[model samples]
Target chain A: MQLLIGTQAVELDKEGFLKQLTDWNEEVAIKIAQQEHIQLTAAHWEIIELLRKFYQLYELSPSMRALVKHTEQTLGAEKGRSVYLLQLFPPSPAKLACKIAGLPKPLNCI
Target chain B: MTTNNKSITCKKLLFISRHAPYGTSLAKEALDAILAASAYDQNLSLLFMDDGVFQLLSAQDPSDLEQKNFAAMLPVLALYEIENIYVHFESLQARQITINELILDGVQVIDSKTICSLLTQQDQLLSF
Candidate 1:
């Protein structure tokens, strides 16, 4: 799959995960979120920033469980709960969040 | 192993770590898979035996080796609800290390007998 980010075609995997990490930017994130039918909010951006930080620090994308833990650590417990995250990013929060953050899909996502 | 039993749904998934941490990326890769499995809310257990015991040792500084301290992520396992971490007691004794020397707490020490029993309960096992 491909996303047209300002006239530039950005490649994506078949599952809609980012094809290249460096190709991610705020604009790309917005596009990806849009494709997922999610409107970017401060709350959503909060998770996205946290995911990006995790990738930078560990050089690896966090798994769903790690994402929740990171959320609880950085944000609060209320936002860290899986139910709350599911409300924000329906379906899979970690996968959608990483795609928007320009990181690879969590290997255990399947 | 032949499948004499009928088809069953996957529930318990075990991750076995036997490699020395930091010398290779195997440890970290294994962790990524474990974390991913945990996210799916699967029944996840981790067994650290053999050189894998070295991964739990404290005071690991990989700066000289230009490697990230991947072991630092061990403490975060609890966040993923992976509280069933098991280490081979004999493996630790063989390495001349004790449980008190480990970086984190709550890791269970089990013998090979228990390892065999745990294997029987798992629907899948991933080893590194």
Candidate 2:
């Protein structure tokens, strides 16, 4: 599948994750969030940026537990709880947040 | 009257890695399995021997190969609480790798005799 950002086609996998990491930009993130029915807020942007940084360091998207732990370490406890993450990205926080972040679906999420 | 006991027991599982990190998928596969097992709250230990010791060497950059740097994943082991990591002392010696060269901290270096005892203590052994 592909996402059209003003006539530029960005390739995506079956699950709507970016096939090319470089394809991701703020505009692309907004488009994907629209598809997932999420409005890109400052709160959401904070986690998206964090996930990108995490992938840069670990080279893999984190499971929910790892995400919470890493967030606690970086952002402190108030924003790191699963409840806060769930409020930003619902249903399945790790999977949904990662999809919008243009990262591969988190391994071990199921 | 008979009573039913419903307590679940966590099994002791040991993963023995014996291959180099990049040449094949064995090393990555072992790491994936270790992370998966951590969610089950099992008693997990990882032992690196032979070429597997290479997985822990610092300053690994796989960008030229277009592969994820395997050493980068080692720190996640601690995050998952899979803390019983071990390295074969003789294997490191044979490869001429020093303990300081490894990236992950708090790994125990054990000789063959200790490895034997560790193996015997495991409820299951997973080899890669």
Candidate 3:
């Protein structure tokens, strides 16, 4: 069965997910993999999880401001600080994480 | 291999932006947010990007000028466990900043690619 979490429904099968990700017909999947260092396999599920949690709490998708503040508070100081969180997810960690997690992308994400 | 199923949480938020933390009241506001969030056991992290990194520069004499330098509040990070600090490597390089120039506490430097990867790993992300 295909799982529809946030951005869109993605199949659990590797090839199905790969095909769906490349449906953009652009190099986005490849670029994300190469530039963002996404593992492709693991990244999707992670994003879905993040997005679901964000929505559950806020009762809305995270806007940029919400995403940043939440990420900083949860991941930053809890560990070493924002640096590690940035290293794990930079610029828009919440967005990327949500994407990889398989959740719907935020409406106002940059 | 096991598939992972972790999600980002939505809790009280505190964002520490040292870079002029606010265009007008960025620093002051950021500190307020941090202090307020900390009260709720909320999540909080600080960023030292671009010119903001200077917020934690080692030595300071804000008192001599009568401008109560607030950087002192940074140390409270340890007590509150709000030590998530991030610095863009490119920004630092462009500014000709050396890691040694700042208060070397919980700061971390990240590259563009890694930053993108990190983004994909969060439930939320913000900038100052």
Q: Which candidate achieves the best DockQ against the true structure?
A: 2
Model 3: CA > 4 A from native: A1-110, B1-18, B21-23
- lDDT, residue A96, candidate 2: 92
Q: Model 2: how large is the Cα RMSD against the reference?
A: 2.8
Model 2 stretches astray by more than 4 angstroms: B1-9
Expressed as tens digits, the lDDT of each residue in A39-96 for candidate 1 is 9999899888988888776666777777887898888888888898888888988788
Tens digit per residue, CA lDDT, model 1, B52-82: 9999988787879877676567876876789
**Top lDDT hit:** 2
Model 1 alpha-carbon miss at residue B86, Å: 1.9
Q: Of models 1 and 3, which has the larger TM-score?
A: 1
Candidate 2 at B3: error in angstroms? Answer: 15
The Cα error of candidate 3 at residue A37, in Å, is 60
C-alpha local distance difference test of each model:
0.84, 0.91, 0.51
Give the winner by lDDT: 2 or 3.
2
Worst 10 residues of 3 chain B by lDDT: B1-10
Ranking by TM-score: 2, 1, 3
Docking class of 3: incorrect
Give the lowest summed-lDDT range of ten residues in model 1 chain A.
A56-65
State TM-scores per candidate. Answer: 0.72, 0.92, 0.43
lDDT of 2 by residue, A1-110 (tens): 99999989999998899999888999999999999999999999999999999998888888888899899999999998999999999988999999999899888877
DockQ for all models: 0.38, 0.69, 0.01
